[model samples]
Target: MKRKQPLLLVIIAFFVLSNFIYNVPNIEAATKLDIKAKAAIIIDAKTGKVLYEDNADELLGVASMSKMLTEYLVLEAIHEGRISWDQKVTINEFVHKLSSPYLGLSNVGLTQGEAYTVKELYQAMAIHSANAATVALAEVIAGTEGNFVKLMNEKAAELELGDFHFVNSTGLNNSDMLDNHPEGTDINDENKMSARATAKLAYHLLNDFPEVLDTAKISRLKFRDGRTYNNFNWMLPELTFEYEGVDGLKTGSTNFAGYCFTATAVKSNQRFITVIMNTKSQIERFNETAKLLDYAFANFGEDTLFEKGFVPESKKTLPVTKGKDDSVKIATKDPLSLIIKNGEKDKYKAKLVLNKKKLNEDGQLTAPVKEGDVVGYLTYEYDGDDLGFITDKESTVKVDVVATESVEKANWFVLMMRGIGNFFASLWNGITTTVGGWF
Candidate 1:
């Protein structure tokens, strides 16, 4: 009885400890960061992998951040030869009135009947967030701001920027446009895009037209090496709230939009794009952005799970029917590299998925396969909590898998002989099976 009492107490204590240990949440699992903004997101600039998000899908006014779309179109036109940097754009009466300093809008004072080079207006728009400069460039490209609005929406759709509506090129409220608003939009309508869409726009802009950064990073804009203005992005070097590696992005604000910013930074060879919409103040936006950038740079890093030409042991070879060679080796078409959370590098599993449509009934590929023919994909499954990509809800990161070498079709005689040999082998096996069953 005495011994039983001690054992019973021990069991009770163990049960209590076990329950406490399991029921208590993991500290790591509780690491959901709270960002004080209406919408915010952080993504890997290279891979579009979303690192963190808070109400990122909510539609809200992007303010001057809307000019990023305009910037993309302008850069695209230049690249396609439709426009040139040296090409001059003439300012009109509407843009002149809109750009007037007395109207309480951000502008560099464009004069009506005066012409500025595409490069000059782009500098004003990109560096100062000048509303009139943006509109002038729009007019030069599309003949009217309303027509430019259509081109903006069309290009937005082409870029797959989901949940976006552009009513103007400069991102100002139509009422602010002083009744010279686009033809199709209501007088009060404003340019709106979700934080995810905004980040994607920045991604495409930086990726497609990298030269925009060359201008965006310029803290002081010099026109004719004389007139100058401060860049709107305060996070740039030597500016207020300046953060290391922050350069070449846009900032936005309006009475309705509060303060918004799309910022990109590079540190330790890793680049991250962050967006915060509707923060309480201009400074608060950069502060919140700093937290996101800190989290990204501190917690995430680029990792290569597999090198190019890596073949999964389980699916290293694929059978090729009617080919000079009976089989072909398969491998990853490129290195499987992506941004990954720190300390979770080994938690990813690789899988080889073959294309079913290209295979015959026996699961064999037809001959005449070319080298580097994409037959399938090499996908990775992460074992940890995945925030998912901003571009889509695809849970796995994937790369193409292709044939390591080409396989020529077998000659007719060689194929016929092979078919005959298979038939005889099958017949012999069936006959032996029946004779064995009789015994």
Candidate 2:
């Protein structure tokens, strides 16, 4: 009795410890980061999951961040075989005038009557944010800057950037284009977009044309005239800030737009895109971006909820009626991953939900089901406030549960044969049991 009492106490203690561990909630405390900008947003580049946002939907002048879209269109045109890098573009009087230093615009000093290749103009536009080079490239692609601006708007619409509008290929304000307004448009015209939409654009641009980063990473390049053009992005190493993982993105500032930056950084296979619009100063844009990046990398990480074609171990097989097999295996069509806060992996739970209405009276699927047929969905959810995730929103990941193999319906003859086999097996088992009992 004394020995049994000690064992009983140990069992009680184990139950108490287990209950405490299970009942204690993991909390993701909300973190507050002060960012000084009119609009700012941070997103996971791969997942497109927004990590932080402030006035992100508020529309504002984007300034030269518009160049991201311009560069994207140029790359698209190149990939489409519309133009090649070595193709020389003539320096027309219009472009020459815009490239002049007297206009107080960033230019690459293109000489009138002289021709430069598509590669030179692209380098100038991307590295120097040269307005003239941008227009030259636009003219080459769409025949006219106005037409290219139309294409830009079309692409913006296609990208679902509802709040974006572009009046010119260059993001120059109308007032700055007083002498250059050959089209006679308003001086107030400038490209406008929300920080959120601009981040989305940048995300697509990087994912679609990763080569843009190669050009954007260049700190300095020489024009055909041997004149040097320097990149304005300060986030690169040996630049103003020297952020470790910072890479190819754009910066913009105008009297109307103030200062704006779309920055991307990668570390540990995780990439983050940060956009800051209308900051007080150029330095502040980089500073605020650094702060945002620090917060995201420190607090957030990703977790895989399910691998492609993965089914929960317990639910490997599901009931199937009127079929040759009594059960069928199932799996998900795609891998399920989510951007979760650090130390919150254990809080996530996944459930397999079947389409019960499709089941027969016995709660088993009918036959003639093909492989990859959708049976239901596997939903992943988190129940705690530790991650600060929106509880009212839908599940984090929902993958389609599919049949692993086709199950043919059982024929009448097959069913009769199976019944006969079961009857004979039962009779043999009964005879053996009776003989053993007699012995």
Q: Name the top lDDT candidate.
A: 1
Expressed as tens digits, the lDDT of each residue in 65-111 for candidate 2 is 99999999999999999999999999999788888899889888989
The alpha-carbon lDDT assigned to residue 200 of candidate 1 equals 95
How close to the true structure is residue 15 of candidate 2, measured as C-alpha lDDT?
100
Superposed by TM-score, candidate 2 places the C-alpha of residue 158 at a distance from the truth, in angstroms, of 0.4
The numbered model that scores best in TM-score is 1
Superposition TM-score, candidate 2 onto the true structure: 0.79
The residue pairs in collision within model 2 are 27-386, 28-386, 174-187
Off by over 4 Å in 1: 1-26, 223-227, 322-326, 366-374, 393-417, 432-439
Cα lDDT tens digits, model 1, 145-264, are 889999999999988999899999988888998888988889998999999999999999998988989988989887652667888788898888889999869999998888999999
lDDT of 1: 0.89
Estimate every model's Cα lDDT from 0 to 1.
0.89, 0.84
